[model samples]
Target: MNLSVEKCPRCKAALEVKENPSCKAIVIKACPAGHYEKEFHPALETYIEINKVP
Candidate 1:
């Protein structure tokens, strides 16, 4: 993450960014009031795509 000031785009509240606890490959950045949410699968998604057989 940027480590800079992160805020919810919807309500302008502070966002909580953390790992999924059970799954390290997944990153969650969400607003506290459920205004916004996002999931990032950085390396796993790319690795899967690159290894997929055409």
Candidate 2:
């Protein structure tokens, strides 16, 4: 898990970061004021490459 601090893009407030309860690989970052939300997929590239069938 990346412990780096992140700021909200909309309001520039410090974001709250956490791992999704259902999926450990996904990281959730969101604004406390509901200005922004995002999910980080650490293995998305690997998953895409593995699923690309020729």
Candidate 3:
């Protein structure tokens, strides 16, 4: 379980992901600073799919 702090694009707040799944997409919540975390799914080799919360 790797925990990292990610920056929110909206307000630049520090976000974190506790557990990262190997074969599934994970959703990160927004911070108290009004920054929304972006969703990400890792693909084979060197590909990634990013999803944003509308």
Candidate 4:
């Protein structure tokens, strides 16, 4: 799970991060009082192919 190392947006509470049941992306559950969750998708990072070298 890709948990955000940041505080909750609403109440400044600790965020709980977990992987989705069906997908590889992660879901963040935070602010128990507010009762909300957010989805976090990992960026598809890759290096591009180039003909010229630096």
Candidate 5:
């Protein structure tokens, strides 16, 4: 079972993760209040904009 890293940052409310069986068990964490966080981000542009390999 994947655990949430922390409680809701906005309201500090309890969070729960639900799996969508129809969608191939996609995990979604949510709080009682309408608050959510972005857990994924692609850095393609960032990689092109900044070259760290020197």
Candidate 6:
């Protein structure tokens, strides 16, 4: 899988990837805005996966 970094939507701050386990397809992002979001693959009904980093 390809990994990338991105910015937070709420505060437009830089976001970093905290976790990406091989057992799971979820990715955790921590922003400088103190906001946190999870990105999941397989396109969940409510969650969206980030494709690229800025």
Q: How many clashes in candidate 3?
A: 0
Q: Give the lowest summed-lDDT range of ten residues in model 1.
A: 45-54
In model 5, the Cα lDDT at residue 1 comes to: 42
Two-way TM-score contest, 2 vs 5, winner: 2
Candidate 2 Cα errors over 4 Å, as ranges: 1-4, 45-54
lDDT tens digits by residue: candidate 3, 1-54: 335666666666676654556534654454555435444534422323243555
lDDT of 2 by residue, 1-54 (tens): 455777666677787875577998877777777776767778773321111112
C-alpha positional error of residue 7 in candidate 6 after TM-score superposition, expressed in Å: 1.1
Model 2 / residue 7 / CA error / Å: 1.1
How do the residues 1-54 of candidate 1 rate in per-residue lDDT, one tens digit apiece?
566766776677776875577988777777777766667777656321111112
Best by TM-score: 2
Candidate 6 lands at a TM-score of 0.42
lDDT of 6 by residue, 1-54 (tens): 324556676676677767666745565666754665555555564566444454
Screening candidate 2 with a backbone cut-off below 3 angstroms (N, C-alpha, C), the clashing residue pairs are none
Once fitted onto the true fold, the runs of candidate 3 whose alpha carbons sit more than 4 angstroms away are 1-5, 18-34, 44-54
The better-scoring model by lDDT among 3 and 5 is 3
Q: Total backbone clashes of model 4? A: 0
- Could you give candidate 5's per-residue lDDT for residues 1-54 as a string of tens digits? 437465666677665665556654334466556564322113322211111121
Worst 10 residues of 4 by lDDT: 45-54
Clashes of each: 0, 0, 0, 0, 0, 1
Question: Each candidate's lDDT (Cα)?
Answer: 0.63, 0.64, 0.51, 0.49, 0.46, 0.59
Q: Rank the candidates by TM-score, best first.
A: 2, 1, 5, 6, 4, 3
